[model samples]
Target chain A: MTDVPPPASESQEIWRRRRGRNRALILVLAALAALFFAISIVKLAQHPDLFTISLDGPNPSAVQKAPAKP
Target chain B: MNTSFAETTVAGGGEQSPPSHSVAFANETELADWIALLKPRVMSLVVFTGLIGVLVAPGAINPVLAFTAVLCIAVGAGACGAINMWYDRDIDALMRRTRNRPIPAGRMPPGPALGFGITLAAASVLLMFIATNAVAAGVLALSIGFYVFVYTMWLKRRTPQNIVIGGAAGAFPAVIGWAAVTGSVAPLPLVLFAIVFFWTPAHFWSLALYANSDYAAAGVPMLPVVAGAKETRRQIMLYALILVPVSLVPWAMGFSGPVYGAAAAVLGAGFLVSTWRVLRDRQDAAGSSLTNDAPARAAFRYSIAYLFILFAALAVDRLVG
Candidate 1:
């Protein structure tokens, strides 16, 4: 395949990937991130309501899913 | 030089026309170039794995933050890929696989690309911090540092396993995405991380199977170049063997449904079969299925699909059930 030109800026992808290093990091940073300012924008997008995970239902009973391909 | 693929292509009459001068007049980068910049293909896989981490984790964040977090992760991934392209533009111009990239193709200057990458990196990290937390932001900073410094600057020029060690940069988004929602790391996320981490060797070496010519032409020390096809195939198969079970960790841990487990099983086995083809056959004389009959290309393509599908299933299980 021929090489494609890069239209987007490079640094942004790096910034996005780096945030995953730690778990506590996500929470502490998010609470402080002031992304709430972006709440208006976030609310406008798809699947905005984040459910607090609490499992209290019947067992999933291990239903082997198929492998993923994109 | 390991000119096998390119050599064979030429032998098989895969005619080489000179670089099309017409492209100069065309001026504007085609759609593929911009797609290359967003690193959309990479973004798809990285985003999928990150989604897995986000979904399988036990806690949750505000939906807004979560979306913002995933968005940041995708942006950050694209940013890193762009900078990598920018930094490697010189060598990129030499290899067949990358010779047509915007920077290398002379569609854009390296300086502007570098500027663009740096700006995106800074913006994404800042956004991560502002939208999420310091930890995630810091991780963002460090991920860029590692990719730019460790992988791009240090390891790539220095070793063949550059892709192996450097693979860490690609795997971080999942944890970042998970943390964005849950606000903390846990066993499940680590398991997810491990799956991607281990899968890297098997996934990349197959591409190297066919791309070794470009690598050799560029003097890059890819595994197929350094170790030869036989050894590389062995390594691919070995990694695939290990990755299959590792890929199943989420299902084994009860985080996903049986559907996910089934998918992982089938795909993992398919990965093994493809790698095994590379390992068992030597039809390219030294090369195998990956290099010759174009199965390696298929494996390379499937590997991308495999990672995406695997992670997507995890997200579906979490969200749907």
Candidate 2:
């Protein structure tokens, strides 16, 4: 087959690749977010008071929630 | 340095002009432009200060949560920077200092930058809420909103007092960091907030002193542009005077020990000396408008170092106490 010249304007192709890169960035960020949530869940399970930490007054659950000594 | 995104060709039925450049990355430089949109240098300060907030608080914070909090704060700050760049593209192009920014340079489109910023902002808030508490999450959201709406969109263009009031947004990280740990605000973090709030004017004004021409060209209403250099210098000295004493409140309140107190005293003295030099710096012995901004430049660099050291002392005091 005879050689065919590419489109005169490469701007379209450049933007398409950029959009693709953006999509990849979004996916990577989403995966990181998912991992963050997973780790958060695990920490919350290990220490129930992790998120409910209060500085104002004594926390009853905090004493109980403290990890047991080996 | 094109000011108009409204530039359009008459041929396409008066339709919007095609983007001058593609947003796609054909090289590492193009990718770097996207990173530049986030203002990583500013983001680093956010991360450092936010991490210190979490570290020095008198409570236990999970490593994972602390990481999440700092990450969210950094991302949120970056989001605001991106949005600021997008909104200020017109003026940014007009200014010598900012003309090379991604959107202004036409390396990236405004629409994409806005979308990237909003998405990061939403994700950051959601992550903070999920990983931390409502108070921290709410503060994070407010900081982002204040930076984007109150600072960038509203105050920046309207008033010479813009950076003064707008500085509060940068101060939120201390509270957010403390809130992440305590899940509530406290006097000490408020004091930290005050330190940053006061530091902003001196820090920004010094840069504006040197960059006055750029702000004037862009019609940005910066203090140096509207109020004259004399007033700007006076205000910088006044702020430095206020910041030094205010920074000592944590030590006086007994939260921090002598180490912090001594460090604050020394750093505060250095800060005063820097600003005083800026104030006294005038026409040379031969009587010329002080062409070299040595004092202002020294003050500007010292201001950054002063903040970092002050926080470091706070952290050290927490350990040593």
Candidate 3:
């Protein structure tokens, strides 16, 4: 009989492990995003102008104030 | 479920497929390869510059948020490093300096590396957006994209000016850091970005001078590989000459105090002297010295320290003032 060929893709173990790792990574990221969301909420409560998400325009927080007249 | 059975099944059924030879991290060195994928050494510089960026900005940040900002920058830098490693694996395998890297050495798979990179990149940017503001997150995302798409995929293999254009990716940290605090860009961070943009060639070319064969073997068209040693050396000095003065712009503009000014001037002169030595030393190409790269190696080491000291000086000046 001819020699058996190898698997083309990653083995089941590798895929399983990779999936597990990916899950863990996703979880950690989700937790971090959650923490950040909590922080943003707190920050927005305390400093509303500073912690904002924006699209299509400059963040209101970033606008530099003009110098006052002497 | 068994290993032998799985292997047998694959071998028996998968006639058209290549062998699935994936292995676990069998040792600490192999585990370290995963970390190496992150380019920790380079990440250190990114972290340092990013930290200084956050610190020296005029506005104050919540300590937790500041920590998060720095962590995001570090992870973001590592993410880019991983993506870079993943993309450059082919050339990395060819180069002596990178031949032993995880993907090239068969210690880690490319697919996972790519996943790791993209995930960290997305996570970092998202976290930055949530913890800080959109401006910082946007800049971080741009930096990662530029490094991956613009530098690694586009410029690196095609042209000698790759690093010059790719240098903008490295320069983004200062802006990211500053934006994390102020939630906006400013002149000081822009100048900081310029300093890094100019400094990159001098730093990388010195390493390339010593590692010329690696780049040449890999077909990477680095400045030293494409331009020849003399031209590369001249360019190194030219960039250093410009970098020194540009480094002082923060002080000149009054964003930083005199202490930083003095430190920048002194450190810059030293940087110039180091590059001058690199310019004068022909042996970097000749392989004549005991190290076979005395001048280039010295300059490469000094460049790292120079950046650290320069940014540290900036932070100190800000604190002292």
Candidate 4:
């Protein structure tokens, strides 16, 4: 049997709805991303020293000296 | 092509009936239906109260965080609304006020709405935790649970006091907001919660008074439907009287300045007068409204403005004081 395509009007209507749903999804995701990014920036700004990392030296208490001469 | 031709169309060599017109229309409104499920009107009040909570709290929150907290509260309240719609879809179809909702109108199925509510509920709580603190997130979660379990499932169908007890769910947003900033519930937020709690029965029952037939048709056991209009009016008056004192608690406790105190006094008096008119509205011997519930409708409208102006005054007092 040969395949039969949907009528043009029906196909267009379906596509319209799909497009709307997709557009809504995209907008929501973009908003969420922006919100998260803004939140991160604000949180980091609030406690700048808390998240800061010092590359100057390892903590002496946290470091293990090479086990003597093994 | 017409609906019949569309329905009988062959696709991929198989005889397939396309979706009906209503189904197609539902598909077209899919996004809008999802939003409608959130009950945006209710979310606005929740967001406003939550925002006030954040503003009035003791400590400073980054504006971004504050915004996030309010967004989470709004989303969480919306989630509750969606779930409430899902559970109440049966009765909703019976009531004129709710018959046109997405679910009852058959624009959306129940499963997706339930899923949407659950997903949003989880997301709001998790985001609240990340953006604010555990206390705020926990209260948000509790509010969701209470609305879904206690109010929607348990009390709403069972008792005339449904809104009375269920009102606590709506009261949570201010507490959640305060918790977001202070990392704890304080006296001010608690007072705000009490004010909203006491204010709810008067506000809701006023609406219920006019919507009595709708509630009766739906068998929801609302105050007017169960205890009759006279009792409902009395309850509305009692609650309004109690709300006046409760609203003044913020000023009495020194959490707010004289501006809020004066505003509360004036607003509370207006509220009392509104309820008094409702109580004395022209009615038949059976206690039904003789003039089509005009006073109740007016009271309902004034109650909304009362809360808005009252809270706005509190925020202004805090800002200026």
For each candidate in turn, the TM-score is 0.73, 0.83, 0.79, 0.90
Please write out the lDDT profile of model 1 over residues B1-321, one tens digit for every residue. 112222223133435432333222223333455447666877878777766666666665767777777777777888888888877876787888787677666555455567768877898888778777787777767777888889998899779899889988887877787677666666777777777877888778888887788898888899989888778878878878888998898888887888889889998888888877767764656554433736667777787778888887777777876
Descending-DockQ candidate ranking? 4, 2, 3, 1
Off by over 4 Å in 1: A1-37, A40-70, B1-35, B284-293
lDDT of 2 by residue, A8-66 (tens): 46645566656766876898879797877776686778778656767787676655576
The best candidate in terms of TM-score: 4
Tens digit of lDDT per residue, candidate 4, span B225-315?
A: 9999999999999999899999999999889999999999999999999999999999999998998999999999999999889999999
True contacts kept of each: 0.18, 0.09, 0.06, 0.48
lDDT of 4 at B60: 90
Candidate 2 recovers a fraction of native contacts equal to: 0.09
TM-score of 3: 0.79
Q: Which of candidates 2 and 4 reaches a greater DockQ?
A: 4
**Model 2 residue B302 lDDT score:** 97
Q: Candidate 3: misplaced stretches above 4 Å?
A: A1-70, B1-31, B282-291
RMSD of each: 15.7, 7.6, 8.4, 5.4
- Model 2 lDDT at residue B60: 90
Q: What would the per-residue lDDT of candidate 2 be over residues B107-180, giving only the tens digit for each residue? A: 66677788989999999999899888999999999999999999999999999999999999999998899999
DockQ of 2: 0.11
For model 3, residues B1-321, the per-residue Cα lDDT tens digits are 113222223223323333224223211123356679899989999999999999999977888788888989999999999999888877877778887777666556577788989989998999899888999999999999999999999998999999999999999998999999999999999999999999999999898887888899988898877878778888999999999999999999888999899999999989988999887785534433344667888999999999999999999999889
* CA lDDT, candidate 1, residue B298: 70
